[model samples]
Target: MRIVATNPDQTQAVGKKLAALLQPGDLILLAGDLGAGKTTFTKGLALGLGIKRNIKSPTFTLIREYKEGRLPLYHMDVYRLEDGGAEDLGLEEYFNGDGVSVVEWASFIPEELPAEYLEIRLNKDETDDNKRYIDFNAQGKHYEKLVAKLAE
Candidate 1:
C-alpha cells in the first residue's frame, strides 16, 4: 500500500494506527534517507503502545530496547553494519523475542531477517521537506492484514 503524508504528524499517525494492530514477534523494516521521519513514525508507534519514554535513533548504539510499552519495542539501526557485523549482534534473539521489532536500514542485514516482514519505505517529497511518500510492502499474509487494518 502507498500512502502520502503531507507532514510529519500525518506520517506518525499512520505508524500509530499500525501499532494498534501489531502482535508479538512482528517485524517492521524501515527504509528511507536521512531525516525521512523513520524515527518519528516509531515514536508514534511507541506512544500508541503506551510507552512514555523519549524515543531516539539508535544510530550508534545499534539497538535500543524499550520495555515500558504494551509490548517491548526493539528498535534497531543497522546502518552502521553496512559492511559487516550483523552476526556479532545476535539479532535473531530480538527478532524471536517477545516484542515488536523495528529495524532501520534493514537492507544492510538482509541475510539476518526472517522469512516474512513488513517493509515500509519512505521518500521525502522534493518540494516539501516535511512531506513523505510512505510505501508499505508486506511479505506475508499476517502483514497484509495488518496493513489493510492500518488503512482503516
Candidate 2:
C-alpha cells in the first residue's frame, strides 16, 4: 500500500494506526533517507502503544528500549553498524522477544532479520518539503492481514 503524508503529523498518524495492529514478536523494517521523519513516525507508534515518555532516534546508541507501553518497543537504528556488528548485538532476542521491533535502516542488517516482517519505506516528495510517500509491504500471512486491516 502507498500512503501520502502532507506533514510529519500525518506520517506519525500513519504509524499510530499501524501500531494498533502490532502484536508481540512483530517486526517492522523501516527504510528511508535522512530527515525522512522515521523518528517522528516512531513517536506516534510509541504513543499508540501506551508509552508516554519522550522518544528519540537511536542512531548512535544502536537501540532504544521502551517498556512502559502495552507492549515493549525495541526501536533500533543500525545505520552505524558494520557488516558483522548486528550479529554481535544478538538482535534475535529483540526480534523474538515479547514486544514489537522496529528497525530503522534495516537494510544494514538484512541477514539478521526474521523470515516474516512488515516493511515500510518512506520517501520525500520532491515537490513538497513536508510531503512524504510511504509504502507498506508485507512479508508473511500475519503481516498481510495486518495490512488488510490498515486498508479497512
Candidate 3:
C-alpha cells in the first residue's frame, strides 16, 4: 500500500491505523532520510498501542522500551550502528518478544531481520515541505492481510 501524507499529522494518523493490526512478535522496518517523520509516525503508533507516555526517537540510546501500553513497544534506531554491529545487540529476543518491534534505519541491519516483516518507507516530496510519500511493503501472509486491510 502507498499513501501520500500531506502533513506530519496525516503520517501519524496512518501509523495509528497501522498499529491496530499489529501483534506480538511483529516487526516493523522503517526506512527514510533525515527529518522524514519516522519518529512522528512512531509517536502515533505508540498512541494507538495505548501508550500514554511521551514518545521520543531512540537515536542515541538505540532502543527504548514502553511496557505501559496494550503491548510492549520496543522502538529501535540503528542508524549509528556499524555494519554487522546489530548482532551484538541480541535483537532477536526483542523481535520475538511479547510485543511489537519498530526499527528505524532498518536497512542498516538487513541481515539481522527475520523472514517476515512490514517495511514502511517514507520519502519526502521535493515540492512540498510537509508532504511525504509512504510505501508499505508487506512480507509473509499475515502482513499481506494487514496491508490488504489498510488498503481497504
Candidate 4:
C-alpha cells in the first residue's frame, strides 16, 4: 500500500493506524534516510499502543524499551552497528521476545530480522516541503494479516 504524508503529523497518523494492527512478537521494519520522519511515525505508534511517555529514537543507545503500553515496545536504531550481525548486539532476544519491535534503519541489520515483516519505506517528495510518499510491503503470512487489517 502507498500513503501520502503531507507533514509530520500525517506520517504519525499513518504509524498510529499501523500500530492498531500490531501484535506481540511483531517486527516493523522502517527504511529511510535521515530526517525522513521515521521517529515521528514511531511517536504515533507509541501513542497508539497506549504509551504516554516520550518516544525518542535510540540512535545512541541501540535499543529503547517501553513497557507502559499494551504490549512492550522495543524500539531500535541499528545505524550505529559496526561489524558483527545480531550476535554482536545479542539482538536475537528482542526479535523472539513477546513484544512489538520497531526497528529504524532496519536495512542495516537485515540478517537479524525475522523471515517476514511489515516493511515500511519513507521517501521525500521533491515537489513540496512536507510531502512524503510512504510504501508498505508485507512478507509472510503474519504480515498478510497485517496488510488485510491495514486495508480495512
lDDT of 4 by residue, 1-152 (tens): 88999999999998888888888889888888898888998998998999999999899998999999988999999887745455677677887888889898877777777798888898889878688888988999889888878878
Per-structure clash totals for the candidates: 0, 0, 0, 0
lDDT of model 3 at position 130:
100
lDDT of each: 0.92, 0.92, 0.93, 0.86
TM per candidate comes to 0.97, 0.97, 0.97, 0.94
Candidate 2 minimal-lDDT segment of 10 residues: 81-90
How many angstroms is residue 99 displaced in model 3 relative to the true structure, after the best TM-score fit? 0.5
What is the C-alpha lDDT profile of model 3 across 1-152, one tens digit per residue?
A: 79999999999999899888889999999989999989999998999999999999999999999999888999999999855689999999999999999999988898899999999999999989999999999999999999999899
Evaluation by lDDT, superior candidate among 3 and 4: 3
Per-residue lDDT value at 97 in model 3: 96
Candidates 3 and 4 compared: the better one by TM-score is: 3
lDDT of 1: 0.92
Candidate 2 wrong stretches, greater than 4 Å: none
TM-score of candidate 1 against the unseen true structure: 0.97
Off by more than 4 A, model 3: none
TM-score of 2: 0.97
In order of lDDT, best first, we have 3, 1, 2, 4
Q: Which sections of candidate 4 miss by over 4 Å?
A: none
Model 2 Cα lDDT, one tens digit per residue, 17-118: 889989999999988899988998899899899999899999999999999998999999999985558889979999999999999998888899988999
